[model samples]
Target: MSDEATGQDPAVEDRFETGPIRPPSEAGSYLLRLTRGCPWNRCRFCRTYKRRKFSLRTVEEIEADIDAMARIRDRLAPAGVAGGPRAAVRRGVVTNDYEWMVANALASGGRTAFLQDADSLVMKPDQVRRVLAHFRERFPEVERITTYARSRTVARLSVDDLRSYGEHGLNRIHIGMETGHDPLLELIKKGATAELHVKAGRKVKEAGLELSEYVIPGLGGREMSEGHALDSARVLNAIDPDFIRLRTLTLGPKIPLWEAFHGPEAVLTRQDDAEIAAEIRRFIEALEGIHSRVVSDHIMNLLGDVEGCLPDGKADLLARCDAFLDLPEGDRRLYQVARRAGLVNGPADLSDPGVRARAEAVLAEVVRTYGPGRIEEACRDMMLRFV
Candidate 1:
C-alpha cells in the first residue's frame, strides 16, 4: 500500500499483481478484470471503471504471483512441525507468523484465482490455456474459473478452443448483451451487432459453458420502448442463453451519455417505470423458442421474480404485466416508492400498514429533496448502469 512497496503512480489507487479483483454486481461471483477498463469503454452507459487504460498482466508477472502465493503458503505450516495443532491453539489461525509462514498461509489459500482486466481471452488461445494450466499447477483445487468476455471476443474463439476451455475448468463466461436492439446498440456504440451477439451467445452454448447475458430493459426509454423490447426479444429468442439477467438501468454522473441526453443533438435515451414495464412486456411478448428464464431479480428491476421458464410461463408473465398496468396511478406510484426505497422487491402487498407507512415516508422525503427533478435524475442515473 505504501509508495516503496508499489512503484505505481501515487495517483493510481488500486493495483494488483495478479490473483483477482472486481466491481460489485447483483450477479453471483466476483469479477477478475482480465483487461482493466472495457476494451471499448466509449459506450455512454458505463462510467464505473472507464477512467483507465487497457493493458495485460504479462505471463511472467502472473506466474511470479503464483510463485509468491505458493511460497507464502509453505511458510505458515503448523508450528508443531510433526503434523499437529498446539494444545493451547484455539479460534482462527495464529496471528504471529514468520515471513515465510505468511507466504505459506497465503499460498495455501490461493485456489481460485480469476484472470484480471476485462478480456483475458484477448490473449492467444494457447496462451490462455497455458495460463489455465499454470493455475492448475499452482492451485489445483480451483474448479470454477471464470472471465468477463466480450461477445465480439468470444465470437472470435473457435468452437474447439472454447470447448477446450470448458474442459479445463473455465466453467462460466459473462457477456453483456445489453439490449438486443441494433438501433440501440448503434446509439450506444456497443461495437458489436445484434447478429454478432447471437453468434457469440450460441458459441458459448456450443462451448458447453454457462452463459449469463444481461438485458437492459430501459435502454431505449420511451422514444423506442417497443422497439427495445421487440428487437431484444428477437435477439434473445435466437441465442437462448442459459440465463437472461435483468439489469434495470441506473444512470450515474460522470457518464458521457448524460451529457448527450441533454445536448442539442441528443440521440441518448432512457426509460421510465411505466415505459420500462411496457418495454419489458414487448420483449417478453416477442419471445418464442430458446428456453431462458425472464429474471427481474436485481434490485433495480421493478418486478423481482418476473422470471421463470419460457412458453409455459409466458402467459403468466403477461398477466403479471396486466396486473401492474391496471393498478391505479396511486397504486402504481406506491409500488415504485416501495421499490426505490428498498422497502420491497417487486409489486408486493403494501397492504401491510407498517410497510406502506415506511414507503410513504421515503417517498415524501424524496419528493421534498428533488421535487419532480428526482424522477428524471433517477432515470438518468439508472441509464448509466444499463446492462
Candidate 2:
C-alpha cells in the first residue's frame, strides 16, 4: 500500500538515505549516510565504491535524514513496550524502507549509529560536528557513533578537531590499515604511507576516541608476507588501537587486485588459507606492549576463533593459528573447505563427531567438484561469495 493509504508521510521516507557498507560490528547500529561514496576509492583490492561519484551531504540534508529517522522512532516507540517494531513491520504498519531501517535499529536497542560512505572524516570538521549534534538531539539514547576513515584524511585533521568531534558524540573511528609495509601500501594504491597510518591512529587515540585498526592477512601475498606481518604489528604496537580487526584478503575478478595475481609480469601471488594462517601467526607473535583486542569477526577470515585481548591473550591467539597450521595436510584441507563452506568455525570444531562428519562431507564435495589438488581454489571460490 502507498504511504498515503498507510497514513505515513511520504517525505519522511524520501529523505532517508544509506551507504553501501558498514563494519561487521556495526550490524545493530543505525546507518546514516553522511556522504554518497568513498572520497578515495583508488585502492586496488576495493570495489565497494567503484564507478560511484563521491559527494558530501550538506548539514541541512543530514539533519533532514535525522529528523525523518526521529519521526519513525516516535511512531515505533510505543510498539517497543509491546511486541516491538519488528512486530509492527510484520503487520504492515511499518511498510516503507525508511520505516524498516528505523525498525531494525529499534529492534537492536537503538543504542548506536554509524555514519556512512567510506570516508566520513573527509568532510569539514565543523560540518561533521553539526550533523553529530543534530543526530544526538534526535536520538539522545544513542551511546556510540562510528564511521570509516582513511588514514590520510585523519592525519590531516588536528587533534583538537578530532577531540572536538569526540565531544560532539562521534566516539569511534575505524581505519583500514590493510598493511603497514610501505611497498605493499604502494602496490595496493592505498594512497597513504606507513607514517601516515601511525600519525592518524595516534592522533585518534590521543584525542580520546576509540579506534579500530583493520589489517588484512595475506595482503602482501607470498612476496611481502613477512614484512606485512612484522610491519603491521609494529604499527599497531605504536598506536595501540582499541581493536585490531583481522580481515583476511579475498580477491576475485571484480577487483583490480586480481590482475596482479595473474599474467607473466605478475608481481603478486595469492596466498592460500594455510599461508594466511602462518602469516597471521607471525603477525600475532610480533605484537607487543599493546592492549588492543584482536577480532576476527568477518566471514572472509579462515580462523574465526583467532580473537583475544593482547598481552595476556597473545599466546592463545598464536596457538589458535598454530593449531590450524599444525594439522596434517588432509586435515588442513578438510578444515579449509568446512570453514569456507560455513560448516565449521575453526579446526577445533573438526574434533566433534557431527562437525567432523559434516566437514568430511563438505571436503568430499569440494574435491569432487574442483578435483583433489585444487581444494584451495575451491575454497577461494567459496570465500568470494562473502565478498
Candidate 3:
C-alpha cells in the first residue's frame, strides 16, 4: 500500500506561509512566519495585516514547518548532477517554493533569514528560543536572523530573556518607532510611549543585538514637525540604534489616519515635500554624538540622496538635503514628480539634462491636468502606493 493508504501521513512540503510585508533589506532572505498578524494593530498610519487576526503558531507546528523547509533545502541543493543544467529539465522539476527558496538563499549568500508577521518578538521567550534553536539546527549555514518588534514588548522582557535571545542567534530587531514626540505618539495611537521606545532600544543594544528604528518623517504633520524632528533625534541620540531608517508618511486612503488627516478638525496637517525635507534636515541637525547610520531607503522621502553615518557624515547629508531644498521651485517640483514616478532616484539625477527634461515634461503634463498648486498634492497621492 502507498504511505497514504496505510494510515501514515504523507510527507509535507511548502507548509510555510509568508506574511504581507518584510523590511526592504530582507528581500533576499527566507521568510519564516511564526506569527499570523500584528498583536497590537492600532497604529493609524499602518495598514499591513489590519484586516487579519493575530495568532501565534504552536511550537510543534512551527517545528514541523521548519522540518519541511529543511527537506526542501536539501533537495534543492546545487550539487553533483549527471547531465549538468539539462538534468533539471529532464527531471521535470518546475520552480516552486523550493526553487524560490534556493534562489533567495543563493542571493543572500546563504547567510540570512527574516521572521515575518509584524511582531515576532512578542512571542514568549522560551518559545522564541526553541524557534531560534530549531532554525540554527536546520539551516546551520544561516548567520543572521531578524524580526520586527514592539517597544513595550521588548521592555517587558527581562534582561536574561534578551541575553538568551542573542545567544540563540536573534541578531537584529527592527522597530517601527513612528515618532518620539509623546503627543504625536498618543495622537497616532502608537500604544507605546517615547520612554518605552528608549528603554526597548537600550535593552536590545545591551543584549548585543543590532537595532533598526524606522522613523516616519511627516508622521507629526505640519503642527508637530519641529517637535517631531527634535524629540525624535533626542530619543534616538539617547539610545543610538544601529540604523535609523527613513519611511516618510504617505497618508493612504484605506488607513484610519487618513480620515483624521482630512477632517476639518484634524489635529495633524500633512507636510508638503519641501516642508518635510526641512523637518528631516532639522532632525538630522539635532542628532549628536551617535554612531547610527541614517538610511533614506524608500522613495517616499523627498531627499533619497541623503544618507551617511552620524557625526562623521552629518555635514554631507545636510548638504544633500539642502541641495534639493534650495532648488528653484519649478526644478524642485520636477524632481518630486520624477522621484514619485520611479523616473529618478535622488537629487543627483537633477544634474543630468535628460532626466531634467523628462521630469520637466512630466511636470508640464501634470500641470496641464491639474493646476500648478496641485503638483505637490498629486505627488503625495502617488506616494500612497508605496505604503
Clashes of each: 30, 0, 0
lDDT per model, in order? 0.65, 0.89, 0.83
Clashing pairs in 3: none
Task: Show the colliding residue pairs in model 2.
Answer: none
Q: Would you estimate the TM-scores of all the predictions?
A: 0.78, 0.95, 0.91
Give per-residue CA lDDT, model 3, range 1-387, as digits (tens).
111112323245655666778888887777788899999999988888788999999888788777877776676565422332234324543234444544455445668888988899788889999999998999889888999999998999987898898899889999988899999999889999899999999999998899999999988888999989999999999999999999988787688888777877577788888889899999999999999999998877777778899889999989988988998887888889999888887788878999888888888888898889899878977787777
Determine the C-alpha RMSD for candidate 1 after optimal superposition of all C-alphas: 6.7
Using TM-score as the measure, what is the rank order of every candidate, best first?
Answer: 2, 3, 1
The TM-score between candidate 2 and the true structure equals: 0.95
- CA lDDT, candidate 1, residue 187: 82
Per-residue CA lDDT of model 1 for 16-116, tens digit only, reads 35322332331222123334555666777776457777777666665655555444344444442222122112323322222223322233343344555
Task: Give the winner by lDDT: 2 or 3.
Answer: 2
Point out where model 2 deviates above 4 Å: 1-14, 81-88
- Mark the 10 consecutive residues where model 1 has the least summed lDDT: 1-10
Tens-digit lDDT track of model 2 for 70-132? 987898777662354456656776766677677777878889999999999999998999999
